[model samples]
Target: MAPSKTVAPANASAANVLSSVVNSYIDKTPQRTKLIDAFLGFLVLTGVLQFVYCVVAGNYPFNAFLAGFSATVGQFVLTVSLRMQSNTENKGAFEAVSPERAFADYIFGSLILHFFCINFIN
Candidate 1:
């Protein structure tokens, strides 16, 4: 008869490490960082939806589609930068830039991006 096989030890070890990392993240991550992550998720969803719409229906006004999609992508990038700069773990790297400054930069960059996107759409 063939020998019975059991779960691999390596697979079990990998699962344990993954579980611990996830638990640590849930317990240690700050609320503000969570909020940024939520926004990033929203941006990704929005961009995906817009692309789907363009694909299913024809992009009659291709310029408008371009503007909307670009805005989502640009905003996502800006938000990620803000999150990185504001994170406590990265404080040493961004010593001179305070969280407030990073947020202000994000807002300013978003406004500029929107303005250009709108102009392109029209």
Candidate 2:
């Protein structure tokens, strides 16, 4: 008789780790929330500034612009994802996603973004 076999689902560990980390952040101090919010505002400001500078600077070094833009966008995506994944009061599809998994997804997406940016720049 053939031996019984089983395969674990991919990302099971990721889901578990993500869940725990997100839960821990719940009920954090108001100061923590304020700090996070302030940081995000800074990111938005940076993006706007960079965009304006790019427009004035012209696309002469299109490659450099692309790389810098990609890195900024990656950071933006990561910050937003962290917020969505860590919100305890958030109910709906977002609640089901673990913070760790979201982070991993954010990281993977950033890598892909960078890959394209690198090619465009070079």
Candidate 3:
């Protein structure tokens, strides 16, 4: 008779390792990073909702769906860029650029993204 393979213990150990790693990370992360993480999570949820809507409603208005999805993705990208640029640890690398400039760039990029999304949606 062939031996039976037991995977439960391996799965449990993997889950435990992942949980500990996440817990450690959460404990060490700064409040600002936590807020940004929450924002990113919200954006992901919004994108998922848009995808579900498209699936349920049938992409009759394909342009609108494209515009919405692209906006979500663009915003997420811009937010991540802002977070990276504003991080204190990256000060040495971004010494020449100020946080205000990074924020201004983010705003400019967002405006450009919205402009394109609006045009494409029409």
Candidate 4:
């Protein structure tokens, strides 16, 4: 007869690993990074809700829905790019670009994106 292997120890090990990872992220990540992450989360939620509304409501005003969804996706992409450039870990990758410069770029890009989105809606 094969000996039975208990699942409890394995489950506990997995839980421990996950807990440690979360703790590390919370402790080591900078406040600015956390703020950016929060904005990213908001964008993701907005996009998901827009998609669900489009699907359920049939997008009668399809252009408006498209513009809103596009803006969310574009903003998310820009924010991620900014986060990557400004992150301490990526300092070497963006050696010449300071965090302030990265933020300026993000704002400029966002303005352009919104302009086009608004034009599309109109």
**Ten consecutive residues with minimal summed lDDT in candidate 2?**
25-34
Which stretches of model 4 miss by more than 4 angstroms? 1-8
Per-prediction TM-score to the true structure, in the order listed: 0.87, 0.56, 0.79, 0.92
The regions of model 1 sitting more than 4 angstroms off are 1-15
lDDT of 4 by residue, 33-105 (tens): 9999999999999999999989998999999999999999999999999999989999899999999999999
Which candidate leads in TM-score? 4
Estimate, for each residue in 25-51, the C-alpha lDDT of model 3 and write its tens digit. 788878887787899999999999999
lDDT of candidate 2 over 1-122, digit per residue (tens): 99988866769978988888777656553554556667788888888888898899787887787788777777777777666666655647686687577768877886787777778777
Worst 10 residues of 3 by lDDT: 28-37
The C-alpha lDDT values of all candidates are: 0.96, 0.74, 0.92, 0.97
Global lDDT of model 2: 0.74
Give lDDT tens digits, candidate 1, residues 5-87. 87679989899999999899889999999999999999999999999999999899999999999999999999999999999
| Cα error, candidate 1, residue 52 (Å) | 0.9
Number of clashing pairs, model 3?
0
Worst 10-residue lDDT window, candidate 4: 5-14
lDDT at residue 65 of model 1 (Cα atoms): 99
Q: How many backbone clashes does candidate 4 have?
A: 0
How far in Å is the alpha carbon of 17 misplaced in model 4?
1.3
